[model samples]
Target: MSEREVLELLRENARYGTDDIARITGLDEDDVEATIAALEEAGVVRGYQAVVDWDELEDERVRAVVELNVTLDRETGYADIASRLARFPEVTALRLVSGDYDFDMEVEGDSIREVSRFVSEKVAPVPEITQTVTHYVMTAYKENGIEFGDGDEDDRLSYSP
Candidate 1:
């Protein structure tokens, strides 16, 4: 079985069983299982995640994209700050990028005030951080493989279960 094919299939749906993958990829079920095990050992397949449409829930999630400008600590580079911020439960994702900002951060909270407090108290306090800009997400139309409300009259759920 080709590892890339297995990886791609898993990326589309993490719940795919070895038998299903074997059927689709035209590979032996045992081989598909072995490849997945090997990839997991190598840390190539990080983990599985479910993309739920939070809008339908009674408890809404507030997400924000935070842009940070930072002065590199010559000794520590970006690792120090990156790992530090990554440890926070509110930080869903963090990346060092090239653009107007040095770091792109995704954070979420139960409420806007909670997210705001996290940014002001947790993110901005780092000494190397020079500036921060936060943009709140108003709505999410599509996430992962699911699409939010398209407002169709047809009898299809807006998102896949």
Candidate 2:
């Protein structure tokens, strides 16, 4: 298959195995593997990720993003502050960015109060975290652009673009 065909396959679903891609594209398994490897090396295929349905989980968990305004102390390193927060399983993703907030944290908890406690007891106490402004997600309109696909009954079941 052509490079365009390979890219379309990869874009549709990066998680597809080489054998599956070979089946779809009519290319040999080794060729498919080489193409995928080349794309990854070129940074086109960055990484693989799982999309979980949080609502289906047994625990009642609420997702939230906490914007932290921090003052990195000379004594405490940024990694050290991040390490402290990471100890709690609730904190999911942490990133330091340039903006009003020093760190953006994605976390989950059973309730608002539980999240509050996590922020107060677990997060705020960290040496660098001087302030935190939280915004709780009331509802997610859509996640990852997966909007139930087209409602049209006639659409083919081919892989997504």
Candidate 3:
């Protein structure tokens, strides 16, 4: 199969095995395996991941994204700060980016107070983190692997239940 075809298969489901891809793409299983291996070696295919709906689980949890704007100080290590934040199980994602915020973090906790404590006691204390903004998600119209599919892909869409 061509690169475009392989990409489409990956887009459909990244975790699909080479045999499955071969069946779908009408290519030899070895070719499919080679293509995937090449994609991985070239750093095009990073890895396979499973998407989980944590909210559906019988656990009391809240998810929030905390945006941090930091003054880049030469002394305090940014990685150290990130590592410190990750010590708590609540922190799920920590990313540094070029924008108004230095870091965008996704966190989950058993309760609102627990989440708040993580922000105050853990996150807020990181030096150079001059500003921290916390947004508690009331409802995510779309998130993670969840996409709202309407017939018109170009149309502005809203999710209503």
Best by TM-score: 1
TM for every model, in the order presented, reads 0.89, 0.66, 0.68
Give the C-alpha miss distance for residue 9 in model 3, angstroms: 2.9
Each model's total of backbone clashes: 0, 0, 0
Model 2 over residues 61-132: C-alpha lDDT tens digits?
A: 688899988777678777887777877899988888887878899888889898988888888887677898
TM-score: which is higher, 1 or 3? 1
lDDT tens digits, residues 3-114, model 3? 6688778867887888888888899988888887788899887776766555557876688999987775676777877887777788888998887778899999878899
lDDT string, candidate 1, 8-117, tens digits: 99989899999999999999999999999999999999888889888888998999999999998567679898999999999999999998899999999999999999
lDDT of 3: 0.78
Best candidate, lDDT: 1
| Ordering by TM-score | 1, 3, 2
Model 1 sits at a Cα RMSD from the real structure of 4.6
Better structure of 1 and 2 per TM-score: 1
Clashing residue pairs in candidate 1, if any? none
**Cand. 3 TM to true fold:** 0.68
Please identify model 2 stretches exceeding 4 Å from their true place: 1-15, 23-27, 31-49, 53-59, 148-161
